[model samples]
Target: MPPLVKLVLIVVIVIAAVVIWGRVMGRRDPDREIVGLTDAVRAKVSREISAGHKINAIKIYREATGAPLADAKRAVDHWFVPGQGPGVRDAAASYTAGRLTDEGRARISELILAGRREDAMALYAEATGAGSAEAQAIIRTWDTSQHY
Candidate 1:
């Protein structure tokens, strides 16, 4: 084949490949991504993020959704964008199943008082190494188990 013809053929093939790829792999919607994440998974991701555990949150998000780490990180970051999260700007304490420090207990109370339940779970997880669901269970008894 002539050099000019070869070049034209190669360009045409590349263009065809590009068009096919675009059609097969449609653009991902950032706002609509991670749609299958359960509410519990969301709470866990949010909890990890709130407790300053970005990597863990990303890992959890990735594992739960099979999303790439970068995508999970982006989604996790989006969770705290003022109006994006569960409206939690603060974090707090340990849990009964964990180390539950006095400070942790007090902070848990504060978090509960502020109505930031998810953040309270995150805090409990932070101080005591409790899992999200465990932290939530323990937090549920905060009012009933204590004299506060």
Candidate 2:
């Protein structure tokens, strides 16, 4: 065998080993790891949740736990709030009371699908009399994905 052929063989073997190692390590139970998180991180996330900053709490939980996005969101939703169980605010609950109509929601979904997120936010805020921050937060909770 030529020298270059031996080198290529070595590289391929090393790449395969690394990929296999990664697959095994990635199989660790995320639920267990999240359950075993430190008290300090739990306290920080709790404070963020208590303040009604759900998005911030999710980001902090993700950064600290290194959990997948869905896992982080689920964990955040499980945190207890003052008056709610697991603190999971429904997407509909994010909207301003008596302001967001069913037709308005459909229009916003359409705008979002058309890649007009900013316009959608503006329209939501205008229609609902919500602040910019409130509108953006509500928008983040919307299920914008279209399914057949």
Candidate 3:
């Protein structure tokens, strides 16, 4: 093969390899990772649950980890029962209540969408609990709307 043709082919192969490798090894679901809860932390929550501690401790765990509000929501929802669904709009309300900027709300919203209703609600509770008034408001709206 010509040198230029060989070089092009090699480049294409390298790009394809990188893409495939990324898909195989990279995180496929940001929402499922339970942001801020290391395996160690999760193990602790498990132990606590096994020991009869309140399951809500996990939510507190997400809050303490300093994960983004939205991520916290996603994490809690994943662990919580009854699957109240992601309360992203609620979190936004809380964040707004706490006086977070539009950028902050947008960030949390994106995180909420990264998963589903269950995860989103947990994050929303965490965000509002952390003092996002806007997030709280969103939750109230959801509660009132009967759509959540």
Candidate 4:
């Protein structure tokens, strides 16, 4: 075999091995590793969820620990259950109150700015616990000056 061909084959093999290893590791219980995360990190994750970025929160968790999407999602979901953590409690309160956190509002604003009114309305509905009609009304009459 040519030297260049052998080099390429070796690189490919190494890459494949790394990918397989990552997949195997990512399938393990991510919660066990993430459970002891500091309050600050948990707070950030909570804020991301409250802001209607649950997937992003999961991605953040995964990036922090290279966990699989499923595992990361499971960990983040656990963070929302009552008694899991103080940050979770605050996030739950904000969610139950039908209030949008600053991050949520900003995301909505971005959607609006991008001419994505429907997406913004959907996000508002999810974040504020509003029905379809109510969500439309709120979006139409949204007062940026008022606290959400």
Q: State which candidate has the highest TM-score.
A: 2
lDDT per residue (tens digit) for residues 115-135 in model 4: 787998899778866566655
Residue 6, candidate 2: how far off, in angstroms? 37
lDDT of 2 at 29: 58
Please give the range of 10 consecutive residues that has the lowest summed lDDT in model 4. Answer: 82-91
Question: Model-by-model lDDT, in order?
Answer: 0.66, 0.68, 0.49, 0.65
- The TM-scores of all predictions, comma-separated, are 0.38, 0.41, 0.22, 0.35
Tell me the alpha-carbon RMSD of every candidate: 10.7, 13.6, 16.3, 14.7
Candidate 2 has an lDDT of 0.68
Q: For candidate 2, lDDT tens digit of each residue in 1-148?
A: 9999999999999999999897656544556545445545665676677678989989778767666677879989877542243433333454446577777888998887788889998998788676676666555544554221
Instruction: Flag the better candidate by TM-score, 2 or 4.
Output: 2
**Each model's number of backbone clashes?**
0, 0, 31, 0
Candidate 3, superposed: residue stretches over 4 Å from native: 27-148
- So what's the TM-score on candidate 4? 0.35
lDDT of 1 by residue, 8-125 (tens): 9999999999998966654545565554676567667766766779899888887678676567778888764211234222223323334667676778778877889899889877
Clash pairs for candidate 4: none
* Residues 1-148, model 3: lDDT tens digits: 8999999999999999999897555533445644565544654544444355544555556544745445555665455321123532323334447744555445545554454444544565564454344344342323221112
Instruction: Report lDDT (Cα) of residue 13, candidate 2.
Output: 100
TM-score of candidate 2 versus the correct structure, residues matched by position: 0.41
Q: What global local distance difference test value does model 3 have? A: 0.49
